[model samples]
Structures are given as structure tokens and as C-alpha cells.
Target: MPPITNVERVYQERYAEAHAYLKATNSENPFMVIRAENKFIELLEEPHIPFWMRAQCNAILAGLTDETADARKYLKGAHTSLGYFVQIRELATGSLSDTAGHRLAQLREQLTKIERDIAAREAAKEQRSAQNLEDDKEMLLEGQRSAQDLEDAKQMLLGPEQEMLHEPVVTDDTRALPKTEPKPASAEQSLEQGTERMDIDSDRSTATLFPPHTEVTADSSQHAADSDTDMTSQFSDNESTATVKMEEDDDEVL
Candidate 1:
């Protein structure tokens, strides 16, 4: 065979790269799968003038179509990828056509398995959500019942006197009355109060003259006698002071 031209070599390399992406879709990584699908589209967009190039393009298209069909089935849209698989299959030929047919068979098997797994997971999730909702509802009702029971117990435990404390005191005159200032004491009342106060002071002084709960011993009698002598001396000094003032007046008059 003659050495391949640069253009043919390039197409071969790109064809292999596209196939690698197609195989990557099996990994089930969403981002990697999306990138692989885009790569396939890019290769299909290239000019496939040569028969070999066109065959490679057809193979990539067939793979892409099957992958998209599987995804669409999960999304619940058109069960088919708009008849794209039929169109790509018609374009495939020889070894390329055989490869596409084998890949499609494998993809269909994988797609069926994936659908079952997805359905099972979704059913389990919905069941768990429903159970959690029921649990929360029961808890809320239990809390409300507990509160009601506590209130009933409170009513049973409280007597009439305790209940009366909680009740508002209602009266015929509910309106507030005008505030009245107090009157000042009259002169007669003031004089009587003063006299009463003086009498109280005199009684307090007399009580203080003798200590309470003491025996009348000779020492106590002597202490009383000493107090009387001190008072008499004070009176004599006052009288002497008045006599001095009177003598001075007489001298001024003379």
C-alpha cells in the first residue's frame, strides 16, 4: 500500500479521537459524556469528501444517535432520537456498518439496565420522603396533645381561691374617679397635736430619770440626791445673774 497523505492521516487520527469519546460515554460521567458528544459533533461537521472519511463520519453519527436516544428515554421525551439512528445506519457500509450495529446492540442492553436502576432509585426516594412527612406530622400532633393535657391538669390541680386570683375584679363603677387633694390641718388640731407631742416628750424624759428593771439600792438613792444638788446649784446661778443686772440698773438711775 502507498504511504497515506497528510490529509488522510489527519482524518484517521480524528476518527480515532472521536471513537475514544464515544467509548468514554460508558463511564457514566455527565461532564465527560457531554464533552465526548460535542467532540463527535465536531468531527461530523468536518468535510468528509473521501469515502474512508465519510465512513468514519457515519460510524460516529451512529454512536452519537444511540447515546442520545438512551438519554431521551430517561427524560421521557420522544422514545426515539427523531429517526436519526435510521438515517445514520443507512449511510454506514462494510466493516464500519458492522461496528455500528454491534455498538447499538450493546448500548441498547446498557440503556435498559440504566432505566431499571433509575426507576428503582426514584421509587425509594419518594417512599423515604413520604415516611419523613408522616413522622413530622405525628410529632406535631403529639406536641399539641401534650400541651392540652398539661392545661387540663393545671385546671384540675388549681382550687377555687387560686382560680379567683386569675379572674378580673368587675365592679359597677369601673370608671376612674377624680383625684382629690388632702385638706390642711386646722389651727385647733395643730394645737392639740403639739400638746400631745409635749406630753409624750415629758413622759419619755421621766422614764429616762430611772433605768428600767433596777433594784432601789443605797447607791441608786445617792445618785438621785447628787442629781438634785446639781439642779439647785444651776437655779442659784441664774438668780445671781438677774440680781447683778438689777444692781447695775439702780446705779444708772442714781
Candidate 2:
């Protein structure tokens, strides 16, 4: 085998140091575990690390953060780093290949879980937004109905006064009494009244010409008989005068 170059030697030393830190993470001391995790983070922060080394560092950090709030970020980093190494066909030992495969499987499961959780949260948020909008619309409609009810109540309370105010005013100028004209009598009624007056006048004239009759005594009865006898004697004298005139006319003719 060829001797290792200076660059190769430096890489081996750094790699050995990172491996020592990974071993310290198993210590019972909490401070040592934190220190080891910090060492891994420091190596990963270096800009010139090899893809295989970065993949191992990221995989360790992903396992550390697996149950923590940083699981998604670290898991995604480990997946990406391992993908880059595999895409470039990097030479991995049996143990390293096994670790990469295991870490990739774990990362994939965690990433899928995180994505599913995110989609569920987004769906819930949209549902809540739609519910809130519907609540607001109901509130607006209720307010409008309340306003209309108030207006209707006000109109009902003031209805009588409004009608009175609109009523026509009554004054002396518009209160003239109606004139009563006498109805003209019909011709039949006039004729009836005239006939009644004529009957009354005729009764008055007859009463004036003929006085009321008194009780007849014997002397009044004898006077009526003397008037009858005088009327008979005057009628006999008229016949005797008419005969004498006829006798004179005969003597003149002789």
C-alpha cells in the first residue's frame, strides 16, 4: 500500500476525534453528553467536510433530535446529506452503509409524519377560518334584523300622533251652515187648498143670508098660512087681467 498523504492524515485525525465524541455521548454524565453533541454540531459547521463525513454527523444529530422539537430539521438534513453521498458513489464500509440505510429509513418515516401533521394543521386552519366567516355573517344578519325590529316598534308607538298631525284642520271659515230653501207646492196641492177656501167662503155666505131657525109658535104658523093665501089671490088676479085685455082687442077688431 502507498503511504498516506498529509491531506489523508489530517482527515483521519479529524475523523478519529469525531468518533471519540460520539463515544462520550454514551457516558452517564449529562454534561459529557451535551459536550459530545456540541462537538458533532461543530464538525458539521465546517465548510470543507467530506460528503460521507457530513452524512454520518447529520445522522447522529438526527437520532439525538428524533424525539425533540428539532426532529424535522435534523431529519431532513441527514436525508439530504446521505442522498448526496450516495449520488456521488462514495465508498462506504459495511458498518457505515448499514448505519446510513437505518438512519435513512428513520428519517423518511419522521419526515413523512411531519408532512402529514402539517397538512392536517393546514386543513384545520382553513376549516376554522370558514367557520369564523360564517359566524361573522350570522352576526351581521342578526344585527340588521334587530335594527329593523327597532324601527318597526318606533313606528307603532308613534302611529296615532302621526295620523292626528296629518288630519285636516277645522275652522269657522270652512264651517258655513247649509241654507234651507222652501219647497214649491205642487199644482194638485194648490188646487186642493183653493177648493177648501172656496167651501169655507160659501158656508160663511149662506150663514149670512139665512139666519138660524127659532122655535115655531102658533102665531108664526098662522102668518105663514096668510102668506100662502095672499100668493093664491095674486095669481087669480093675473089671469083676470089677461082675459080683459083679450076682450078689448076683439071689440077693436069689430
Candidate 3:
């Protein structure tokens, strides 16, 4: 209150220094340039310190302590800086913590999207599998029906096939199939029946299979004509091909 003395000026300077220190220690926020200059003037005018400045001084002392190796190291790098702005610029420029945090967040989001897509794909695959299984079942049913039809046909022909196998020669019993229903004869079989009904041989051998036809054993000259096929249309129409069936019957009309 009285005339400001050197002791007061010294005390004010100490107080401002303490606050500045606190700012560095994280106890006080960063001082504006004008505010710091004001503190410089105030320290010369009065010998008292504010609560905020006092906190700053405490923080400053903590940073200055020899055991605070991390603070010392940071301060060492800051020694190259001209002002607080350099520190701000260095922090804002590129920080590993910030980049890593951003990348981690992005990766987490991507992972979530990928997981959702995978789940959807799996669901679609399962649906497709189910559909395919259903289709396969239908196909199996159709195949079963076809197989059953084939089995029925085979069963129907079983008796006829056995009779034919027992005797390759067509007998009276084999010509007439069993009651289960004889398989319809092919065109070849019908032709064979016509040939059996009409005794027309390709070779002039006296081999008469028909009862009505007379048995005749021919000599060499007749053999050539017997083999020739210039015959009736009705006989050729019924049986296109002539088989060389010969007979050794005792009865000879020709």
C-alpha cells in the first residue's frame, strides 16, 4: 500500500514465477500472452499471489523436480521451441495416439460390418442348402417312381423270359405268355411267326416247318431256285427276310 519497494517487487516476481511454474505442471491452464505480461507488471507492483497462480507454481515445481524424467525429457524438446505455440503445433501436427485411436475406431466399425455381411451370407447359404435338399428329395421321389415302373415291367416279363431261357426254340407254351401279361411281340417276332406259318425257305432244302406244306428233298439244280427270293408279295410283306430252314420229313409230295 505504501511506496512499492524492491522487496515487494521481488516477492511479486516470485509469485508470478510460481504461477507460471504451475501452468507447466498441469495444475494451471496455459497463460495468455497478455495475462502473463500483466502478471509480470503485478509482481513488480504487489507482493501477493492469486490462488490460480499458486496452483500453477505448484505444478511448475513438480515438473522441475529431478525425479520427473518424463517432464524433463519433454521440456528438453520444448527447449528448442520459441514459445508455447511450437508445443501446440508439435502436438497438433501428428500424434501416434490420435492416429492409432482413429484407426482403431475405423477397424472396429469395419469388423462389425464384415461380421454382419458374413452372417447374412451364412443365412443365404443355409437357405440355399435347404432349398437344394428339398429339390433333391423331389428328384429322389421321381427316381423312385421310375425305378418302380421298371421293376413292374421286369416282373411282368419274368415268366416269359424264363421260358425263353429254358428253351431258345419257340415252343407252343413259350409262344403264349403267362397270365401276368405277355410282353407285346416285336415286329421281328411277328415276321418270325409269319415265316413259321408259311413254309418259305431261302435255301432249297426240304425243311418244311409248316404242316400244310409238302416236304420235298431237291437235288442240285432245284437248290439254286429254292435259294432265290422272287416270291409272292403277301409272303414277302409278312416276312421280309427268308430264313434257310430245312426239313428231313418222310412225306414228299414234290
RMSD per model, one decimal: 19.5, 26.8, 32.8
Number of the top lDDT candidate: 2
Better of 2 and 3 by TM-score: 2
The model with the greatest TM-score is 2
lDDT of 1 by residue, 1-254 (tens): 89988887887787777667656655343323434555555565677546766766677556566665565454343225523565555666323466766776666555555456556655866998999999999999999999999998887888676979997786856446766889999999999999999999998997798657767899989999999999999999999999999999999999
What is candidate 3's lDDT per residue for 73-169, written digit by digit as tens? 4433443342344446558875436775566556455445534544565586699899999999999999999999999999898978887789767
Count of backbone collisions within predicted model 2:
0
Model 2 off-target regions past 4 Å?
1-98, 171-254
Q: List where candidate 3 sits over 4 angstroms from the true fold.
A: 1-106, 157-254
Residue 101's lDDT in candidate 1: 66
TM-score of each: 0.31, 0.33, 0.21
Model 2 is weakest, by summed lDDT over 10 consecutive residues, at 26-35
lDDT of 1 at 188: 100
RMSD (Cα, Å) of model 3: 32.8
